[model samples]
Target: MLDTQMPTPKPRVIAGESHDWELVIGLEVHAQVATKAKLFSGASTTFGAEPNSNVAFVDAGMPGMLPVINEECVAQAVRTGLGLKAEIHLTSAFDRKNYFYPDLPQGYQISQLYHPIVGEGEVLVELGPNDQGTPTARTVRIERIHLEQDAGKSIHDMDPALSFVDLNRTGVALMEIVSRPDIRGPEEAAAYVTKLRQIMRYLGTCDGNMQNGNLRADVNVSVCRPGQYEKYQETQDFGHLGTRCEIKNMNSLRFIQAAIEVEARRQIAILESGGSVTQETRLYDVEKGETRSMRSKEEAHDYRYFPDPDLLPLDIEQAWVDDLAAHLPELPDAKKARFIGDFGLSDYDASVLTADTTSATFFEAVVAASGNGKASANWVINDLFGRLKKDDREIAESPVSPAQLGGILKLIEAGDISGKIAKDLFEIVYTEGGDPAEIVAARGMKQVTDTGAIERAVDEIIAANPDQVEKARVNPKLAGWFVGQTMKAMGGKANPAEVNRLVGQKLGQ
Candidate 1:
């Protein structure tokens, strides 16, 4: 059992009220499990396939079909629990959550309710920079992580008169990780979800792709008197908690924050008017920036959860758990520490590099191959990352491979290429992949390392501009002008350090 002591609640600001309020928040993050096949069947889990094409017989709930457990999925869930430092139940059972929807072919979802696989995990979320640029980390306790099958998507935009169901996503495995009502604000909620996504991504259990609906959050929001939470903290009373409204299907971070803010204020208004806040499921209109009621929030009893008849209780041995734990990859925190210690990176740089596993791997590969830690980090974080953002490309989809990038850095380290020339070569590599050395040589973009050659160029520049030379001899500040002119004359292929040296030598400054 993790520590459950809550700190003194801070005051919250109501929209148009004089008295301060406290906004309490909790989140249910539904992360799509990264697996090759659906949870109960052998259907392909690939996204963007034709509708109904990826559905298996069990996924489609065909008559006479029986559900079979995927051992890999179970192992993946256990791996996630271990990563979260949570309690892994040796024997967990699945329950059937009955519901009706056009997207749900079976009219029930196979989920875990009675015995969740993982329990009582804690996530430390780093709230964005404060005014002093220092980040504050807040720990949100995770209640449990339970596995369930995903429903198909109901698309309503294909025709105004008809809605269509795409079963491509049906029966996909999802891990609903529920958090305690520990979040204090919208920013904290977003941070919690982001941190959870990062952990899942690091664990290799979830893709954490919000755009693909692979990762989404349901935000539970409520408000009470400023000091009421402190009372709950001391007493551990759930009744002191105000009624909560659940905002469903919030995928975008901006919209998540907006929905929470709007919903919290709405609750505050209702309570201030002496009307109790209704517990309901609400949908956020991204365009309108408001949340509207969808339906009354259903309780656990409403779902009538019971162990699935077709599936047996999931049981695993301690040895298998221990083996899986031993083979687990270095997680985000460890990787961040290693980056700081091994590569001499600051905490901020380490955080950025380790935010995603792919980017961190790419950075390490470039550093290892090129033997330029700081330089490689700079290029990867600044130049390559900027280009990737501009092109809307992921680090894994970067056109410039780690080897090619390392080769480019090596050329710069060996003084065979200038910084400007290296940048141009990078662009070339990014657009058209090739050997950096060959590209530099083919384009005659090598830096001018010969002192004699550079000296001659500096001399010519000085002879043409006697006035600037005289100014440099007097003030010594005008020497930068000659350096610029020399580099420009060399088609930006001049080594900047050599150019400055040669320019100062010619001007006698």
Candidate 2:
């Protein structure tokens, strides 16, 4: 929940010679529902399939074909709604949004306009650079989440003479999550989308893969005067915000940030030049780094939307919704809180683990197997995560498994292996995949815990460096040098604490 007492930040100000401008932004994120088939037909929804092969007759808009809704897709939307902490309408109907595209075989898309499946959710977005290891947070309200069918892709690059239509993406289920015009800047907009994607992925409602077009966004951007946003928030008046331009189908976060900055500047330039910003649709050209007008924006009336006559209004039972609610997983927010409270983890580490479901799951498994949450967390975050990221592998694709990592941490905890020895054991297990204890035993990686052996090693290092040993007696802080030498002389297998103890005893003499 957002703290109401905290003051909202100043509007996103773009300084100008004549005047300062502010930016207002909203996002309509389209997340492809994770279902086996299309929203309205039984067409396969597999990606990278043969072009037009998976599409069904209804998806192709054949003369006699009628749409019969896929119940599973509807359930997925409901699951997503619950994940967003949104309201699920018991009765919602689909409408035909009439439009023409070379790839849209139906010539109109089936979407929810008048009554959507979900309504009025809130997403708590955490702003990051994570300064001081704590992120600032704000609540971005969701206006609605509606289920709709996707349009096909028009491939223009493949044919220079004519464009090619691939209906492979056609008729896939999409959940268009519309947000309130609460975003004040580009970073916030990207964070909003990211938080939404994270939640949906946790729920298994959407894969949230923006690269594969599994997720995309239409960014609504406008620039207003500095204090106008506060007024808009108070009055809930759409007019208080300036004329917004819709930037279509943004997939990358970096590109989204750049597009917002460029578009805001464009609008600022237009306003400063004595021209009003136009309410229009625009395309972001990545290479040119500018937004160009695509077409005039249309109101709902222009689409001539009507209830999809072939399929009746979808009516689901509250009992079913309740069942889904009961099964909802521990979301990122809850999981993060638990990590901080239970494991004694820092806010930053908790956020990093819970950012993705797989990472959290892996961390928990390591904790369970090792019976040492703190050690497991450090190993997971500092060592395993760094290695996995360097290798460019997902958590699921890691060379080290939870059980294997757990065994290594266990050796460290039991004093069977020193931290330095554990690192060596980790490398061996990561590459060879064997028991940590067995590897430590076979390779003599065990820490030398005997006080007598450690004392002998310390005496040798002291005898070898008498001047340094005298300096350590003069300055107790310099005793760490003796500790290091003793550990090195013992092949780094001596317990660090015992080595420190022996070094201090010999130095005091």
Candidate 3:
């Protein structure tokens, strides 16, 4: 839980020639609920289906086809609310948001307006480091999380004279998480979205795949005087924060950050020139790096929202919500703290491990198998993660499994294989798939742990390079050369610790 009384961070300001303006941001993230079927239809929700192949009669808005709600979507939304530490309303009703689009076969959307399923929640966003180099965080308060149906795609590029509508996504359930205007800048906005995605993914409520439009954010941006935001917070006045423009369907974090900067500057430019910023919906052009007006922002009244006549008000039991709350998975923040405390990892390392469930699960499995938290973290992060990144693969797709990597670490811990030999064994296991111990034994890769053998190898190097040995006696740092030569002469199978001890002992150091 975050302290509600935490100090409001200083506003992020953009300097104009005459005055500096503060940026006020909020996000309405639409996360498609993880369910097998559409919200009001029996149609499959599988992605990458043939265009319009997944549509049901009701989804296509065919006459005399009544809608039926999918109960799993509701449960997923409630689960997400509990994960975010939000209040779940026992009774929530759906409304019809009337609109017209070729992709919206229903001619309007079914959404929650007057009463949302989830009430106020808070998301703790980490904003990198501050002046003192400590991790800085801000709590972005969620206004509501409401469920709605998604519109289909409008394919305009297929033909010069015609546009096509793909109704595959129509009627899919969406959880629109609305946040207050607490975010101060583009970075905070991006962080807020990322944290939401992380939390939802952990809850298994949403997949958070922005590329496939499983998750998207509609950013609300406005510029105000620096202290005006504080006043708005105190007075609860929307006017204090200037007119906000909604940037629609921001799927990429980089694009979200860039859109905020460009939109804030665009608003700043308008206000500085003695013109009012328009309250409208806009789109960010990736190529031009500019925001263009899409349409005037619609108010609730304009959408003509009313209690959805086709469906009854949804009333769920408190016991069901409690049941979901009890079974919630360990979230990112809690997992991160546990990683820090239980594994003795640094804050950054913990953050990296808990950034996603797959990496976290893999690391824990490695730790469990190897019984070395620090070494497991080092191998998983530096070696395994680096290799995965270089190969452009995810942890689930890695060539080396956690058990295999843990086996390699076990060999190192038991002094069965030197670090250099471990790398060679790792390569063989990764590329050819073999047990580390078996490979080490079969290929004579076992470390030369016997002091006598190490001593003989050291003496040979010392005899072959007497001048170097004398120089090693003069400068202790030169002793490393002897260690390297002895290890190489032993085919890198000698224990590094024993080799160092033998080298220092032979040099009388």
lDDT of each: 0.87, 0.89, 0.91
Q: Please provide TM-scores, in order, for all candidate models, with all chains considered together.
A: 0.90, 0.97, 0.97
lDDT (Cα, tens digit) per residue for candidate 3, span 1-509: 22234344566889987899999998999999999999999899999999999999999999999989999999999999998889999999999999898999889999999989999988888776666665678988989999999999999899989999999999999999999998999988888888999999899999999999999999999999878987998999999999999999999999999999999999998899999998999999999999999999998899899999999999999999999999999999999888888989988898889999999999999998899998899988998889788889999998888888999999999889877888888889877997788998899988888988888889899999999988988899999999999988988988899899888988999
* TM-score-sorted candidate list, best first: 3, 2, 1
Clashing pairs in 1: 12-21
RMSD of 1: 3.4
Q: Candidate 2 lDDT, tens digit per residue, 1-509?
A: 22333344445689976898888999999999999999988889989998899899999998989998898899999998888889999999999999898889989999999999999988888775343544466788989999999999999898799899999888999999999998989989888888999998899999999999999999999988888887988999989899999999999999999999999999888889899988999999999999999999999999999998888889999999999899989898889889988989887788889999999999999999899888888999999988888888889998898999998888888989988888888888877888888988888888999999998988888899989987888889999998888888889999999998878888884
lDDT at residue 220 of model 3 (Cα atoms): 95
Off by over 4 Å in 1: 1-16, 60-64, 155-168, 505-509
TM-score of 3: 0.97
Residue 327 error, candidate 3, Å: 1.4
The alpha-carbon RMSD values of the candidates against the true structure, listed in the order shown, are 3.4, 1.8, 1.7
